[model samples]
Target: MAESADASGGGENKSVHVCVAFNVSNSKMPAFCEAACKLLAHAKADKGCRRFDFQREVNWLRSVSNEEHSLFMVRQGWDTADAVEAHVKSPHAQRFDGTLVSESMLVCAPSLSLFGSAMTTSDLAAIAAEARATQGSEAAEPAGTSSRPVSAARSNGSRPSS
Candidate 1:
C-alpha cells in the first residue's frame, strides 16, 4: 500500500481517526455481522479509507457469549471528516441504514475525534509494522485446527497482523 497523505499542507487539522462502537442488541447479532462485513469489505476499497478493521469483544461467560457489540476503526488519512460523511451517504452504508435493523434494534453515531500527529500515514504504517513484527511466524499458522499452513505471501499482504 502506498503511504501518502492527502493533506494539502502540514496543517494539524488534516485527517482524523474514527472509532465507532456499535452496541448491538443480543438478538441482532447475525444481521449486524452480515451487514457490517459487507460495509467493511466495501469501505476497504474506498479511496479515502487509509485503513479499516472491525473488532468483536470476547465474551468470557456463556451468558454474555452471544452479546452482540463491536468496534469499527476507520482511519481517514487526510479527508477524515468528509470521508466519514460520505461513508454514511455511500451506497455501501445507506444500504444498512434501515434494512439491517429491526424495530427492536438500536443504533448510535460514532464518537468522532481528531488525532493530530497520530493521524498521519507514517503513524499508521508504524502501527501496522509493529503488529506484523510481533506476530512473526504465528501468523502463518493454519486457519482453525487444520495443519495446512497459510500461504506466506498471502498472509503478509492480507492485512496488518492481528
Candidate 2:
C-alpha cells in the first residue's frame, strides 16, 4: 500500500476513499486474491472503516501487456486518514504484502489514489501566501498582466495585437 496523506486538521472529520490498482502475474492472481480476502476482513473490523472491496478486472485480458496476467482494484473508504494509515500498517496488510507484493508476482507497485478529502480555502490561501513570501522576486506577476476585468480592455471579443 502507498502512504496516506496527512489530512487531519481543523477539528473537522474528513472521510477519505482510497483506490489501489494492481496488475499481477496471471498464474499468481488466485494467490493474490486469497491473501487480499484476509486483509480486507481484518481491515473491515478496524475503527472508522466505512467500506472495503476487492474487485477483479473483467476486461483485464484485453488490456494487460501480457495476456497471461490480470488486473484488480481495491476500493476502500474510511472515516479518517488515521484509519487508512493504521490499516496500511496493520499486521494482516503487512502479511499480504510480504506474501505477494514483495516478490515478482505483481507487474508493478500498486497505484494508489485518495479522494474526498476537504480543506478550507483559508488553509490553502495560507500555503500560497507562504510560498509567495519564500519565492521573493520570482513571485511577481509579469508587467503586462492586469487585475482588471478582461472585458474592460476587449469588449468586442477581438484578440489584442502584440
Cα lDDT of model 2 by residue, 64-145, tens digit: 4356666677889888778888988889888988988565678666677787655678767877887677555544757556
lDDT of 1 by residue, 64-115 (tens): 1233444334344435556656776889878765655443343344444444
Displacement of the residue 57 alpha carbon in candidate 2, Å: 1.5
**lDDT over C-alpha atoms for residue 40 of model 2:** 83
TM for every model, in the order presented, reads: 0.49, 0.62
lDDT of each: 0.55, 0.70
RMSD of candidate 2 to true structure, Å: 12.3
